[model samples]
Target: MELIQNTPELSAYLAASDVIDHEHPLVRTVAATLRADASDAYTYAKAAFEFVRDTIPHSHDIGDPRVTWRASDVLEQGTGICYAKAHALVALLRAEGIPAGLCYQKFDVVHGLIAVRLPGEERWARQDPRGNKVDVDAQFRIDREQLAFLIRPEFNEVDWPVLFAEPHPAVLQCLQEAVDEPHLWQTLPTEL
Candidate 1:
């Protein structure tokens, strides 16, 4: 079941960040390109999600391992891990006036992405722009959630960060500068 929380405080997720960089030219350009002709919030959000998930290949999966942490960098480079991709999605959604935030789950390590407050829905829905792996495809669904993996207590994956108004800085930095795949995977942020 999806956890539903729609407090007035969620509005803070709409702000631009140093990492999210919603005001950056690349973010704006990419957002405009993805959201073209989308008349509704759901449509716009879906379009943005699809673009990020399919258009931007995962840094490691593409055999092009370049650490890009900022939303603008992710948009410009057309690749990133889940954290950077989530930052881009948050920037695009906030640019379009939708309230979006970051959420984290542990699998292999702490993976992250944007949690969108879907149109006409009080609860924020998870929309991971990171490309699919195995049987998982991060998608946009307002009624029920479909994410990469569910948390298992046995793994000590207990610290799930929800409702982050912006991307966590340590995560951004670790991903932004990682030079190789092993290091990237090793550097996944678990602290915040």
Candidate 2:
């Protein structure tokens, strides 16, 4: 699928903000550590992707109730649903000067992930740092998508193609207002 940026400017994807807060000290520290292991932007992106994917546990998958929306909180508290995990991964990517954005898919509910444009690439690749289950496995790859969930078109599941520089308001508002994972599950968006 072709990825469309909400903003025409590439800088928008790299800029730090309240959600994708790459400029935060913690994010920078993590980026520096990941950078030490990487010789180039793509290598650093792979390391960062693996860092979030392997290190952080998806709150719902682990039966953790805590809700986190921001990138730093996902890193600090160590738990988040898909959207929060995407935020963290995006921040880490941006920290290394990669252009990253948010994207979504709908299954039983809205699933969040991120897309990254390597320094000179004309296209972006979608990645799921939502962690893995014995059943659902996701991987980082640019040539093809290895997202966590496959859409069941018969079930009316859809992939929202419009990529954003920030979280979708509906998803962000739900995450912000949710008190816990249980609360979040009850209120998670069904579509964009």
Candidate 3:
């Protein structure tokens, strides 16, 4: 019997890493739900994305001292900053065989989903689950992405890729077992 080789693309997106433990029971449950409910990859991606965005609260947003760095922990704790929430989203999407990675803005990043709105395209959208806002509703699509925070000029923000497989050690360290807001902020990595 010969070993079957996974395509590079499949391997990169689907394989579990330290932070993204897709094999965990919770992750598998989300994957199963996406598979059962969604008819296509795009639909599945949207469902998974919404699940995390709406369900999980940002740690700081909730004033929750505990910070989550792992996808499993994010699900278990139901609170995480943008990075932790993104980790959970990436893991969920990857578990469903959808290609997902981390994308960031300056002070506030786009979390896991990345898209460029094209001229007159209505479907590309994004959202920030960070808070509930009358003006900001959920946005899910590849065409007109609607994220939570508008990139402000005063922020001096930069767009970049932050994590792919695992939470960066520096980030993990910043959030690791933090018990309060002051400690969390004091330890948070600034290089993002």
Best by TM-score: 2
Across residues 1-192, which tens digit of lDDT does each residue of candidate 3 receive?
111122334356567887878889999987897779888777777777788878887777667878787899888889888778878887887776655545556664233333222234332233333434565565665644467666566787654433234555666666676776567766565565
Candidates' lDDT values, in order? 0.77, 0.92, 0.63
Collision pairs in model 2: none
Which candidate, 1 or 3, would have the higher lDDT against the true structure?
A: 1
Which of the predicted structures, 1 or 2, would earn the higher lDDT when compared with the native?
2
Per-model TM-score on C-alpha atoms: 0.87, 0.98, 0.76
Off by over 4 Å in 1: 1-8, 159-161
lDDT of 1: 0.77
Over 4 Å off, model 3:
1-10, 108-138, 161-163
Write out the backbone clash pairs for model 1: none
What residue runs in model 2 are displaced by over 4 Å at the alpha carbon?
none
Q: Which structure is stronger by lDDT: 2 or 3?
A: 2
**In lDDT terms, which candidate is top?**
2
Candidate ordering by TM-score (highest first): 2, 1, 3
